[model samples]
Target chain A: MASGNKTTLLFYPSTTNVSAKIHPVVLFNICDSFVRRPDQAERVIGTLLGSVSADGIVEIKNSYAVPHNESADQVALDIDYHHTMYLSHQKVNPKEVIVGWYSTGSGVSGGSQLIHEFYSREVSNPVHLTVDTGFTNGEASLKCYVSFNLSLGDRQLAAQFQEIPLDLRMIEAERVGFDILKTTVVDKLPNDLEGMEATMKRLLALIDDVYNYVDGVVEGRLIPDNNIGRFISNTLSSLPKISPATFDKVFNDRIQDNYALVYLSSLARTQLSIAEKLNTAAQVL
Target chain B: MANTMARSFLQAVATEEVAPPLRVVQMEGLAVLKIIKHCKEFSPALVTGQLLGLDVGSVLEITNCFPFPTREEDDENEADGANYQLEMMRCLREVNVDNNTVGWYQSTLLGSYQTVELIETFMNYQENIRRCVCIIYDPSRSNQGVLALKALKLTESFMDLYRHNSFIGEKLREKKLSWVDIFEEIPIKVSNSALISAFMTELEPDSPVVQCDLDRLKLSTAPFMERNLEFLIECMDDLSSEQNKFQYYYRNLSRQQAQQQTWLQKRRTENIARKAAGEEPLPEEDPSNPIFKPIPEPSRLDSYLITNQVANYCNQINGAAGQSFSKLYLMKALQDN
Candidate 1:
């Protein structure tokens, strides 16, 4: 839909469910492509592949970088390369349709509209995701936008990029990997026990924070919010009742069974090593 | 200075003669996240992808990865899989990404990844890549607050034995390679660029304990433990059957030995009679006798895979139980206080 306007017309998509859900993998891919970009290239751009549900929620699942050349006045995209990459990606994930395109920079630049138009030709309405890969404002700001086609009299090609709500969602395994990636100073990946220890420590810190907040509110040093109070109470109530005696008995019994198997495995391993040694000795003989 | 140069040259030669074993698998954070997303998104249905990176000395650096096409969707032609991989790698190379296939990664369900299929995939990769590893990620285990990602490779001795296709008892004995020697695990190291680390730090929510951390506090791990136990029992049964096959082979071999002994004695008697009669005796070894036929020894590959799977399940159960114990104790203390 277009309107003859002298300036610009900002219009949202017809559907009310216009929000976008972005997988952390897409962000990781964008950042990676940005890092591996050519030395002279100022920014890297790629096509976002996902599916639009019946409810109209756009889920961006996967992406691959598309090579392009741009300058102050001229912009050119490798349409052939984009087509081939899309076909190959489709062969892998047939369901992941081209939903939008992403670029790495401070925000949407002047040449983004041309790329967005190219993607729009592929899909109905393409989203434009601009990642602040440079961390210009001391943080990498991730922003997603859906464009509105504004008909400005004779300039019927112009469009405006409108910001849309986007959330970073990941599965359980991804969160664990993300947590591990957060530790940049320690390059070594944590073992299971170390992960558990860190988790416990974080839990303990949280408990202390909650306890302090309650204490402050009770002592009248801070105003108690009813919403937080209900939230804390609800959490406490959700915990199942546990009698110390019953729990101890169940816990000990389960732990003993588990430890017994652990011991059995250890014993099996010892016998294996011994058997290997014996076999080698007999072979030599 | 001349002496130093000579010593350096000698050391270089020594290093070339004995290349270092892959002790650490250095994976980029981008690769790690990419793998997690791909595997978890398709979850219950297992998926695999090609790993691209360099093989540095003593460290296998994984830089990037792309998911493989689902078999059913790959135009129903098996050859398309290889073509897709080649085209994808070529496209990625054009984008300045690492296209060298270092290894491949696959998602596993409940740590049950040890299989002959996996080994076959490894042998296929071995043809081109000088040294490679298979990275196994178990999403089910990670759900229990454990990041179960491991890098595994075929041991040199085991690979040598595998190439001969002779996995007999004697062959294994000669190689001194037990079932445990089939796969060697290299420790994994995860490192992120400064900018990614900063971005991840920003991704962190205001709360110290996110949803995953809260999920760790969940006390009900009985389902996970139960599934692991079920798999363990099945493995034990399979292992016992394998043992029985070996037993049957041994029995047949012993009977054949006794038959040979009797046949040799008769032939000796006949020869002695012929000597007395001044006539030639028949040959002792009979090629057509069914009793003298060789009984083929069964392959230990099946048993080795089962044992590996069993050990994997055991470790998983132990880890989940241990984590649960910690959480329970913390909860108990919190209540008491």
Candidate 2:
């Protein structure tokens, strides 16, 4: 809460602390940068471009890789390149300022403080995102941290990277593409007609899941959760009430319209081809 | 790793004189996300970017991309935009990413991207890059639970005719090209690294599906259909106007033809009279006569684009209607039970 880190939590109250919400793009960007890193480099760091909301949530939306040379004893980042790239990104997206910095590796390293110290001057309480690109534990562990200054007497000696809560959020459009990518790894993507079947199948599966849970609770086989019951009922009540005849008519109308549209489009294409042919034929005179 | 493979492919292909015919546009998952983020962030306002990838054998792989600076309407800003792109690519090259300019991408609204300006942009790119694709992303259409991203390229035959500034019907017939031949859409394949795929698997909850999948089953598709209809009607009007231009051209052409016939008839009679009188006869065809001048036929490029737009809208409406029908029936069955 802001009681102790009041200067850091400018947008938060004393109770709920700051949390980091990352968009899928940022994670993809960090992974890309790590994949394209210099052959000898251990980690790749980048500037996180996003904005902080009034509720103390840092939403990272974009990022660009910053070339850095790090060793066991020293670390050097191309400060000029970072500033120039940030300015270039700013020209297009003025709203997304420097929210934090992201690095790829297992965990925070000793030189992270130096880099964090540099970023602190650029932004206050900047977030340090560590993506385990190494896949250390059979998976990449996404960890976001904030540093706290450790002072001995009056001199600040070091900054500690304290872990914070991180959540992954994606927009509807991104979800569509991500779904395709995820599915492509296992099988070929579905076309238009197949897409409809896929959607219906998923919906039916979800309904079955909810029905089973509710059925178990009703039979006293499983303990019922009030939140689950309310949510299920809410969705149930949202369905429309109509006579079966009216529903059949509406369904028929939809199918007919869809067929008509497809027919019209194909007809238009055929006409276009014919028109082109005739126009060219007439030009011969 | 895809990184080393992409680089080796680039080296192998860059040395070739003529690249093989592109069979697919394989895009890295990272590139797709970057495009989605850039486009969704600035919806309604048009945005474009550069795609950096390798043109491997029979497959144009898009490994990375960066957005261009949103420019002002001036020549100075135009130059600045170019410099910014170069600088950004330079910075990316320092980090060892794909820096080759394979093509560019732009966001559209409701699939209104089939335009002359788009063709002009392609022509501009053709000067430097031999093979490039223009990725079109429609943020508005993506609301319908479909990934509205496409890679388009000018058909080689169309580009050849376009370069000569000739959309003449005679040339089109000779080339056997049609309106639909103006652009070729290459199929897109999404590819990702094994590490990224594993990471994504970790991100999922105990459930196999995402929470957002519920939105796909919503029965309210009225807005999407309405917008498609609006665009379709506008395109129809544009197509008619294009047709009107041709009508006007043919009318004037007939008038000119009639005037030439009259002048020729009079000249023949005059020549006969002059011969009887032993004087030199006047030439039947006069180079200085205004009636002999040729009228340039209007180009059919605009109408071709309009037709393409109308077809795209119709296809979209059909897809959305089909999806909505399925959702509606599922709801109906649920209600009955």
Candidate 3:
């Protein structure tokens, strides 16, 4: 398929080409940036930092907004600021580079093409991403587009912005966080006690998995791999060896310390109020 | 340090001494997601919900919302609608959430949201809550790869005209309102709390799934573009007819004004001749004056709405076509290389 030498454009379909890999963190950042701007009408623009792979997977790792409305000069300044920020971030995490740009909402609006053109100058085949911040539904949706300018006869240019697929890649921790976030979507949060119990249950499940593996090997039903043996040893060694009585005492002391801190803060607050009253009285006198 | 900065910033903006230029609508991530869920759940059937939040001056923070149960013949079930909303609010209050009705939400299909039903709903909301907005969620469009969430509110002029129950062109012209000005699209911000931010960070490690998934990235443009083109064609026909209707009214209005002017001139000349001839002038029988006085100018509200809907359709076509064009370009470029 790659070696096809067909020169005619009519027969080639667009399905085989471009795709994108968006890090979960990029979305979290986009949402956070949006949340920071409470004024609803303000247009938020941001640069997406990531790299496009040879196979055309645009991996977007990080993003930050360009604040509220800015003057033309300010927009230039913002681009510079974002460039520097991206450079500094790249120093820390070098895998991601500039892949595209993103904004809030669904389809391309009046000025999207202009913005896409500007981004095109920054990177070849710049991906235009729109994150549906308007959670019209229970999930934030993301749309990626790659724009190209086709020359119609006599130097007339027609720009096309096509939607590309975005794949969200998350680490295990991110998956857990996403699950927790999903739970919040139902607007239900388990109380602290329930949360603690859930955490314990998950921990027990992990232990049960390890227990089964060990039980199988001991019963000669399965041969233990070096990875499993090493994992078991590491887990056993990392286990804390505290007596029940000592553990109980430590937990009680920590709780007492937290209570004391709360009491001291309240005392401080009252003292500050009294001092303020005294200062006002002295001034009146 | 960050917490204190945020706290102080909140304190600084606490007092909204004057009406802010634009009302800020802050929505929690959960609330937004819930709206999307509701919209998707009731696909094809219209879904509506009451926005629960605190409205502090210019800031309308939508902390929560609850969907109105599906009811048959919503117009006849007005009492049922109110009861359902009240029931939901009461439940939210019991849960100690923000229960004030800041606005409402409706799921639209492919930006086909401009309609009489929507306007009526907006009018009702505006009458009760001055700052109420209608969040239009288009699940179908969103499914095509973008989240179609828009916060729209009827402009003050449109609301006033609707309140006066006047759809006359003269009245609308007096207000200097156009179809485009009827509904103002407010920018939307989806916010998460500090806790959620911290949790997102905590979720960053040992994420289990890693795959170069290509299924989502494929550009499937035919059905979407075809649908937009079809809707655009429909809108074009409707728009032309709407224009014709407006033109018919304007033509009649001008003709009426012209006939009245000519009659008044003729009556003045006759009165002068009668005075000169020492005879009482014919009793003023102005057929055009009283008859057309009460005839309110035909309101362009519907036409304006149609025009706006047409523009929306045009935009969809433009975007979808642009996308399909780019896809072809990619294909051609790949083939050439």
Candidate 4:
């Protein structure tokens, strides 16, 4: 799978960074190349490049599929080519380094060890990322494996592939975009009446939770915390002082305006269709 | 030179149509992750789901899918189940996603996916939707560091054989079919939008320290190799038994042929003798006999599937062995250094 080279990762300024955060762009690239290959082969190999935050959090930014090569010599050449390309990419954005490599499909295969060995030569502690790009229901499963070299008798070997937890972290903007993409899949438009209704429903549910908490405190079933009380008072004070009658009138007017807009749009559509019909009839005559 | 190669690769990608002549199955990354989650949730039990996506001629874009609910069996309840599924699809339609059942997905254990139920299900779907595919999710293999997500479709020959319920040697030979060709694996692509790419790019920042962790090189292929061996052994046993059964049939057929020839020759001589005596030749030698009844040949599809399964297991084992050998080789070389 070709991990999209275009999508870059923006590192968030976090005080504590322990885990690797994968940018969605790398995923896009993997998916793109995976499906677009001339022959629909399951095995796709690519290199993972990203910058690690000061706190050991790896932020995967870019990836490119290593073109399929059958010969051992060709594979080595391809690896070199990938390294040069990565260096060129680093020139433009010097933050990223060769973090690891990725392959489309799940589970490390027989060839995976060989591929992993090649990547190991390029980077120390190369993370072998397996993106399960095969669709069953929803979402491509991503797995990060860190190899551990072990000693068996007198010979030392990489004895284990330990899976590391992958955090698919997105910035605030990305999160919003992700949510919008999710909604679009279901044909739910953001900022529409249905969206607003769903938001209101969630808001009401939160209010119910808050009301229950207050009731519990009032009835002595629970104790209220000073911080929570302070927060509630602060929130209440921040509320705009609007009369109930005016609030109702404003809400009604907004709803009416929305209905009128819908009606006007429908009328315009009908008029356009009628005009087109008349023009066609006149032409025929 | 690399730049030219990269450019050519890009050109290839740009010129490539989203859809090819044969239907291409593409899935969003999130959809695959969801299936893995579903499989994990229902571990030790067979889980199945309906694939919902748009089928644009050559590209089957699987946008979403939902797990099918287990239903209680009753003669009348079957209708209710169908209606309930329809209602669910209708709800999906309201959401503007492809609600059509393009195919279905099932979680398999140890790649033991070929089964009567799976074939029957594929046929049922094929009867309605021509481009339907079955996506198999293997969680155990995934846990061992490879995500086993595969898109499978019944080959036309296999489907035809299935429709006719004929997997006999003659039919198989006539169709030129084999187990490997039974399930045509459509390459899967996980797709994302430009917006996602842009967002990912925004998340990058420069860091001074490059992590070179030694722990990442460790690997353990023993357990996986063992499992593969076990499965391979089972497959071998199944294959051998199938071969033995076919051998038995061959033996029986040959024995019957010999007996029939002897009986026919005796009848011919008797008829000749009767003609020489000027008698009406004993009602033209009827070859019909209880001993000549044909022995039914068992379908070779199962054996073929087992053979393929065995090959798959062998490939996996070989990979594990090769990886282990390399690891050892690296360690030994380092020791010498």
* Chain B superposition TM-score per model: 0.92, 0.92, 0.80, 0.83
Best by DockQ: 1
lDDT of 1 by residue, A213-246 (tens): 9999999999999999999999899876888788
Docking class of 3: incorrect
Q: CA shift at A44, candidate 2, in angstroms?
A: 1.5
* Tens-digit lDDT string for candidate 1 (B101-122): 8999999999898899999999
lDDT of 2 by residue, A1-285 (tens): 102444432333242477998888787778778877888888899899899999888888888889888888788989999999999888888998998899988778888888988999999889989999887887769998887776666777656666778976455324564565544342343465565677677777887899899899989999999999899889878877778899889878877776776677667667766766666675523
lDDT comparing candidate 3 with the true structure: 0.62
**What's the chain B TM-score of candidate 1?**
0.92
For model 2, what is the error of residue B59's alpha carbon versus the real structure, in angstroms, after optimal superposition?
0.9
* Each candidate's DockQ: 0.47, 0.45, 0.01, 0.01
What range of 10 consecutive residues in model 4 chain B has the weakest lDDT sum?
B208-217
Off by over 4 Å in 4: A1-285, B1-20, B70-84, B198-218, B283-288, B330-337
Arrange candidates, best DockQ first. Answer: 1, 2, 3, 4
Tens digit of per-residue lDDT, candidate 4, span B44-129 = 67788789777886878887676665445687777865765675565444324456788999898777887777888988898898
Say which prediction, candidate 2 or candidate 3, comes out ahead on DockQ.
2
In terms of docking quality, model 2 is: acceptable
